[model samples]
Target: MTVIDSATENVAHTESEGGIISWVRPKRVDVDLVIPVYNEEEELDDSVRLLASYLLGRTNEFGAPVADGTRAAFTWNIVIADNASTDFTWAIAAKLCEDFPGFIRAIHLDEKGRGRALKTAWGQSQARVVAYMDVDLSTSLANLDDLILPLLGNQADLAIGSRLLPQSRIRRSIKREFISRSYNLLLRTYCQARFHDAQCGFKALRLETARKLLPLIQDDAWFFDTELLLLAQYQGLRLREIPVRWVEDAGSTVDIFDTAVKDLQGMARTRRTLNSLSSEGTGEKENARAKTGANATAKAGAGASANPAPALLPDFRGALIPRKLSYTV
Candidate 1:
């Protein structure tokens, strides 16, 4: 097999893998695709190896017009973020990291939320773009580049695979399809969200945007994706919705009703939070205007500067602090 090296040259895997391994062990990366897993020991090895192989091939297809009109190729890495799995998932992940060297790495978290795992792994990464997908590989691997292109081209701040899009091809049960549509309908009605799908497991974001917004996301569970999307919309960030090919995996562990109840509650809470912020912002603006009016009155004829600068909005960056995440490849 041939793999693209750091220099963008195609070389046999055995020849280039070790050299790139040495170079990337301590350097920044172009893309980091995280797979957040919890007690998925049975699927760990196959899924990780498949993803790694796909990404290795993906690098050879890059080098088009990316950010700033520069011809850049993607040097991608896979991160397996294990969320406190009681099973042998962590052991398998560590072995995969060791086997792939610089091409793959693993992080073990003490908590059991997929969101928590992604939060830590992405925060610790120095990659330009960060992404995550389900371990079941329900979404087609062919759409990976499509999900990433908008961010890479600087055309959008976030990219999401939308199984709800009209062009999306899905092989799911009628019950699941109904539930998905209903959930997205609620998002549109309650949050006034514009994106087609928020619950899709396939998603990516620019690292800068992730850093700025991940702090404000309050949910540390299944609602994490929804919360992140809602916050991004509230912040006026651009989103690219790509229609994806999806296949529902059999023997899935998710409880639809339980997750739906939690999601609805999360939606309500997010709406309240956004409304509160808006009210606070309005109050701050009014106070600033009042002070400005007072100053203008006092200096009416003293040749004061005609225009005063507007007050800056509150900074929410401190909401979540990034920890020193440990990883071993």
Candidate 2:
């Protein structure tokens, strides 16, 4: 064991199937970002490298957020969740764990479902917050700070990226665009959901909240994101939607129409499930929140510049003092 003078500075390592594991061996992290994949060999390496390096650039060698922890916000790592990829995705992910050591890890599942992969990743994670995004990195990374800061400041219980928002910038084929808008429209129309977009892969939530909700989630596929968010809304939890800059992946493998049909079925099932929960009084849902997408934007943390949010970054791996956060609501 590699030992340090104190527990706060201590670190450990163990050789495992995935590689030298260390980060969580001591305790939990501030945030965990999982990239769930299925047969993504071609995009696996580059995407992981880009994402991990981008994350690393935010922190210094002392495991503290850069420049007095303002920009760093949280100590974080990435997990590559492989959903029975029939290719070299797992192998590549394992190598990344080795390359990044404590900052990146991998998990393999025999089943193939984005929801299953996420449920497993988020369920097992010890981070204060757990989040996921597509391997393609469809959403711009700038929006990530906006996504995470709110959850940390208690400004939101969950945060999601939305391409349908008026402020969003997007580029894609007409068919995909139409399908995307139509799906969210149904979510607003029939489901009575207030959030603008439901299916964006980029999402984050406090692990505390995730623990309560993951077990209740039923769908284990593409519809999982939508279902999970709907349940959060049913519980009347705070949700933040950030307008994102997204560019379509031309060689995407998803079968849009087939997924859409399945999603319609899932939506129907979810509508029923939500109604049941509300009737049973299990959700504590707000009539205003469920009926319309008009939840007020949370106020920003007072007396601080907006750039480094909340004014104070918490002590690393230590206690976090909650503060009310304000930003684009």
Candidate 3:
């Protein structure tokens, strides 16, 4: 397989004990797939290696065939986002980076939230497209092409794997299936979301679109995926969903009841905020109309610009400047 030496060389590597590594903007990459993990010491190494191999092995679907000794049509980077794993996960991550020089890198976060891990990785990525999947191989690797192809092909701003799609093949308990369907039904009734699945771990986004929506998302736990999709739909971002083959991972750490409660709360809060913004926008338009009589042109412009909406989230890489972050291996 053609190695991504150029992109790998641009990254900083661990040199000595207690050494500090500063984040630098590296050469642009075509795709950066982030695997977020927490205390996954047993599974991290194998999963990452498998994923790296898969990404490197892919050939261009169309165009001239990729011959041996030539770089593939796309260059990819695998980012291991470790969210405060209390085990040897960090050490394993560091070793993987060392073993697969240009193919892999790992990030350590002080917090222990899945959303937090994703936020750090996605925000720091310099790749054209950013994506994340569960460390467990519950979803077949075969479906990966479908999940990322739309984003790479520029057919959609975001792509999500949907186990709820009619064509999806799933192997899971009846209890889990019912919970998933009921949760999605709640999302549709409360938030009016269009997508079939919201909580699927397999998802991708154009870097630009991710930068816009990441800050607005407030949930830093299991509710994160749902909140993200809801805001993206509310703001009118294009989203595409593909059927995926998924199997239940018995080792899943999710607490169904707790997660369900949190998800419901997150949905309610998001709907309230969106309604408030809509109201403010309407009020501005009405005032502008009252002030101007026959000057329809001026009124329209004033109404649109007046009472600018608040920033989606506090100060999360708020500016649209170049994406850069402190790098440590």
Candidate 4:
């Protein structure tokens, strides 16, 4: 969690009239889209340039009524989180930061763990909406609107890309497809989980929701996503699942068998924890269940642009950089 590069300036906190302190976050961006990499030197450069260009509006050919049809211009930046890549991934990320400056920032961690990288980056981010996608860009970039707009509009606390949905258009091998379905099925049968496709690698959350949920996560790897989703449900956070167009690239470096074993172990641990929580209930207010994938006819033209404005909550705030963490794995 070392501050490799402070791409943002820490703004001063301003107070309101009734003495309710407002923590105007250090880097007040609309969204912080984080891409965490372990050893992805080969794919890093092209992916960054591609995604950066889209963010800069260079390749945004599709602004037509996607994701609730709320077309509002908001600020966003990308964070290249390198989690101790043994290859040249770190060097490439640093160079990209130099190339893009404020829009593209890079951070380095001494250890390797996807969850650790995401937690470090998301914890530091005070962006109105914090999001992440895999570097491979397996999911459609157009779906970003679906994943992010709800959080911006306060429609849901968390949103995830789901390849398992019937509306999803995915090109994947039989083995991977089987593995994913089986894994999620196990969660549903054994853990009574409702949300689907926890391993889709595309998700977003409001900064306030992330702030309250992050500290409860323990896994430092792939299981982080599932663990976070489970805890979010336990806390009664509204979760939305959006169907996505995904193409599974064969060049993925993930070790499926090894990851599966580890994931099973993580599931066991998580289930035990959930059981304990069930036995000891809390007296917190229940969260409202969100209706996902609703079809509403958004105003066709410019009228729809101003429909749901991006509203940044008043209390969400954090430091300029994530604090250093202590891990033993």
Clashing residue pairs in candidate 2 (N, C-alpha, C atoms within 3 angstroms): 299-326, 300-326, 301-326
Q: What tens-digit string does per-residue lDDT give for candidate 1 at 50-153?
A: 77766655322122222333122478788888788899987797678667777877767777787888888788789889999999889987788788877888
- What is residue 206's positional error in candidate 1, in angstroms? 0.7
TM-score versus the correct structure, for each prediction: 0.78, 0.76, 0.80, 0.76
Cα lDDT tens digits, model 2, 60-81, are: 3223345533335578878888
- Candidate 4: count of backbone clashes, pairs at least 3 residues apart or interchain: 0
**Candidate 1 ranges with C-alpha deviation above 4 Å:** 1-24, 58-73, 294-329
Query: Model 3 reaches what TM-score against the true structure?
Result: 0.80
Candidate 2 lowest-lDDT run of ten? 318-327
| lDDT for residue 124 in candidate 3, whole number 0-100 | 82
On a 0 to 100 scale, what is the lDDT of residue 110 in model 4?
77
How much lDDT does each candidate structure score? 0.74, 0.75, 0.74, 0.74
Question: TM-score of model 2 relative to the true fold?
Answer: 0.76
Tell me the lDDT of model 1 at 21: 20
lDDT per residue as tens, model 3, 1-329: 11223355644444432221222224677888889999999899977877665556533322223455233346778888888889999889877876777678677777889998899889888899999899987777777777777788888888888999889999998989999999998776666666788898998999999999999989888888998887777666678888888999887878898989998998778877776666676578678667876666866777657855433331222311111111111
lDDT, model 3, position 42: 89
Displacement of the residue 231 alpha carbon in candidate 1, Å: 0.5
lDDT score, candidate 4, position 60: 48
RMSD of 4: 15.2
